[model samples]
Target: MWVADYLSLLITCQAMSQSDMEGVEQCFLDISVDQVLHYDGVPAVEPWATMYIDAIHDKRFGDAIWARYQIFGDVVDGLIDDGRLTVLESIEEDAVGYKKNAPEAFDEAVAFYKSVTNSADGHPEVIEIIMRIDKEDVSNRYFPEGG
Candidate 1:
């Protein structure tokens, strides 16, 4: 499933018309993966709060990183309620801090998520995973182990 998603993300980007791919921010599209979660069969599935946090490790997307973290918090909150995945105690602290510092960035993050997930078919799920993993890389910068 993960491989399918990964390939889908790559193929989707490749299939995207030049203008469509160009519309995507080069920074958001940075091709990096969190090595911690990239191992085979990690069961690294949903409520992907950690992945979202990890993505912001890059300073180039400073505010955007914070924004994606915030958005992940919101999604995780809902997922927790829905019995999807347990929220990690460590990230809960950062999520609180992010909410206080960058409320608007969080909003933008949610919009970013919706925009990416609510798209064309084919490799849609792959795109979602890519976004989740990329967002996590950004958030990892705040975590001790992530650095």
Candidate 2:
């Protein structure tokens, strides 16, 4: 799912209360650190914007798997746009890092992400966004792995 789609869960929350924050913690599941960086300046959908800003600023979330998972989601989205993955989804806690089948694009995404994460000038990890048209299952697999 795209960041905008993932943020839908946050919009459903009534307010930025503790429970609300707790409820939408997983909403951060499928977005990128790069995307979250822009939320501060861009007008967002209510409590989601407030929540994301706070979440990204948290050192623990920013440095750990939470952020990685979020960015992975973006990477997967990017890969899909690039034609690497056929499909991706969040299938509970058991299946970490959603994937349909193995694809080389996953490696590329991970490599870049890890490279930037471990690099000195990486904090503001930025990723390219590709706009893709939805296609059927039959021919989708033949697509390339980048925009």
Candidate 3:
């Protein structure tokens, strides 16, 4: 089980850009080890979290990435629940399928992020972190090779 966890973490790190790795690292540092190991909803100390922290702190990764990993799901779910599917759809259009246009999609995403940040219960800090992410950081993850 440990090996499997490590391997998955390795794969995730390998796939991430240097900045994203740093963000992951910061997240680990900000969160306690106990939180990672025993969070109620999710095991925060899983492979992805561990690999990110190790890569940035131990491996000396880049520093451009913002810490957004922790709140990613919450942001997405909030958007969906709020019926802001246009934001998600725009991102998908840019990231994949027939309308794969990074600039436009990124612009829309940014706008949506800004809106979220300004609204009540927006979790400004989390939105701020996510706002720092750019199209290049996520495009490859969402879109298949040559897609």
Best by TM-score: 1
TM-scores of the candidates in the order shown? 0.24, 0.23, 0.23
Over 29-128, each residue of candidate 3 has an lDDT whose tens digit, in order, gives 3343233333544445344455434533443221111222322233344343234443334334333432234455545545644543223332244334
In Å, residue 1's CA in model 1 sits off its true spot by: 24
Residue lDDT tens for model 2, 23-136: 222322334333444453333443444444455444223233323333324444333334434323221111222122322443443343434333222223222110011111
CA-lDDT, candidates in order: 0.38, 0.33, 0.39
| Span of ten consecutive residues with least summed lDDT in model 2 | 127-136
Compare the candidates by lDDT and give the number of the best one: 3
RMSD of 3: 15.6
lDDT score at residue 136, model 2, on the 0-100 scale: 18
Alpha-carbon RMSD to native, per candidate: 13.0, 15.5, 15.6
